[model samples]
Target: MLKFLPGILLLQVITVVLVLIAPTELSGWGWLRLVIPVGIVGVLTAAWFSSMAAHHNKDEISRLQECHAKEREALRVNAERAKHRVIKQAHQETIQEVRRTSTQANIKVGMAFAGAAGIGGLLLLTQFITLGLLMLTTAGGALGGYVLRIRQEKAKMELLPKTKTKPRLINASPTTK
Candidate 1:
């Protein structure tokens, strides 16, 4: 809109100069007739071009806005996917740690049972029947407790949220107790 200010000013200046310099015979109405029609045409032409420019700008703005919206949506999806991947990795790490600790526990328990059996056999051979039975009973109790603990851990793992889209695990870390 402001771009045509200089042209409009120039036209007004030219009309004033023509009206001032025209011969006295034609001074009154001659310049008025020429200037009025020319001014009208100039104004109409400026308006038409300004309207076209405004329409083009409107379309460009719409296109840019749509492009930005699509980009925003893509960024949101990527962020969600990244969040899921991080959660899944955490879960995998927790499971692997549990397996490693459980393996070690199993080895220790097996050793305990084996030691108990060997000592119980020696005690029995030495005619210590009562002591041998007690030792075996304690080992049995230890085995039972280990089995129960494993069952509890499996149950805990199964308690994780079922939704694959947004899985959540509470108490995912192994408890010492």
Candidate 2:
């Protein structure tokens, strides 16, 4: 904005000097003709300044709109992320609850089996049979845990929505009408 002021002032000063340095023959109405050049220069100078100002204004507006659009997009993404986080947390909580319940049930069943094995070993009075029964009970408990894990995974899969494929259209026709 400040760079053009010196040039504008210099042009005005040159016009004034030319107007003053004319002979009387060339000075009368001919001197007045100098005003034409001055007017032309003035008009051109005004147009240059006006165009610069208008361009500056347009650039500023474009920058402002760009900033606003970026902010809006950021806000929208943040909102979507927060919503997804909440849903994920809920799903995690449900999984945790299922794990807890399954663990408790497994413990109860394992204890019952162990107690039954202990009573049967006492009736048979054999240490080898008691150890074998204990091993079998542990293996069964492990298998039950694995099955529970599979059930939990199946439940989680069921909770998810199914994906649907969109149909694609293909046409071999040209657009000439």
Candidate 3:
């Protein structure tokens, strides 16, 4: 069936040329003029379908495969970036949380130190030097706690992986962090 294309095309081309070379007027074979074109079209249609039956594929399979591959690649890249966005957003939130915690810790340390200074003053008023020194040591401990919290936050930041800058276009590759 597939071997009939060249023969069918040649026959069609010859018929068309013969018709072209003939007279323009169709007074003699009026019905034949219409039937000839219609018959040729039917024959070509039958030949194309029969060829497909023998060959298993008549359409452009390679072109369709290329289209599907491109679609798959785009979808794959989009899925990766979607996952990256979630992780990147979480990392930024964690950094912001660390900064907030550090600020609060420092504020609390300042208030605690102020209270300790008041206690020291009261002790001094009563002439209790040893107890006043104890209050000062307690204040030092509060400062130490503040320093530890900040240091811990810094360590946490260090442990976290940084996110890289994303490209403006989907086709562009991501830049390193």
Candidate 4:
């Protein structure tokens, strides 16, 4: 009704002008005489229906807006969940990498110890050095291997990206509403 006000006013103005200009022109009841009344009624009815349709359309538009808002909120929630999942996965990967690195370090240390023991045994059997020298060399080799293993482990750890020990705050709440 409100939207059709302008159209109604325009129609009224045109009707008044036509009536004033042709007072006796539309007085006859021939087929041509029916045209003016029919046309005027058709225009008015079309304007009324168009206004009603516009109201219905506005209602539908509001409903669609609400649906769109809900969909946007759902997408936001899903995005947040995905972000948290990625952080968790990264943390797990970091833990696995650290464990793998530690295991390799232990294996290297074991191999170094075994090789040093084999060398000391060979030296003792061949009498390459006195018993005291053999003991000193074995002790020195064992100590050196232990220190080298520690250094290697430190280097390997340093090569890896450090993982955050504490859980991170991914999203902070807004101070203003």
In TM-score terms, candidate 1 sits at: 0.63
Clashing pairs in 3: none
Q: Measured by C-alpha RMSD in angstroms, how accurate is candidate 2? A: 10.4
Alpha-carbon lDDT, every model:
0.79, 0.73, 0.76, 0.73
How far is 1's C-alpha from truth in model 2 (Å)?
2.1
Candidate 4: tens digits of C-alpha lDDT, residues 1-177: 576677667777766665556546454465455567658766776877787888889999999999998888777777777787888899789989988987897798778766766777777778866764676577677778787888997798799987654433345465796
Give residue 99's lDDT in candidate 3 (0 to 100): 78
Best by TM-score: 1
29-141 per-residue lDDT for model 1 (tens digits): 77677677667766876786677779879999999999998888777767777888988899889989989998998999889888997898888889999999888888888
When summed lDDT is taken over every stretch of 10 residues in candidate 1, the lowest stretch is: 163-172
The residue-level lDDT of candidate 1 at 73 comes to 72
Candidate 4 clash pair list: none
**Clash list (residue pairs), candidate 1:** none
Per-residue lDDT, model 4, residue 151, is 90
Candidate 2 accuracy as TM-score: 0.45
RMSD of each: 10.0, 10.4, 8.7, 7.8
- Model 3, 122-169: lDDT tens digits are 897899989997987888887788788878977987998875776244
**Which residue ranges in model 2 land beyond 4 Å of their true spot?**
22-31, 89-177
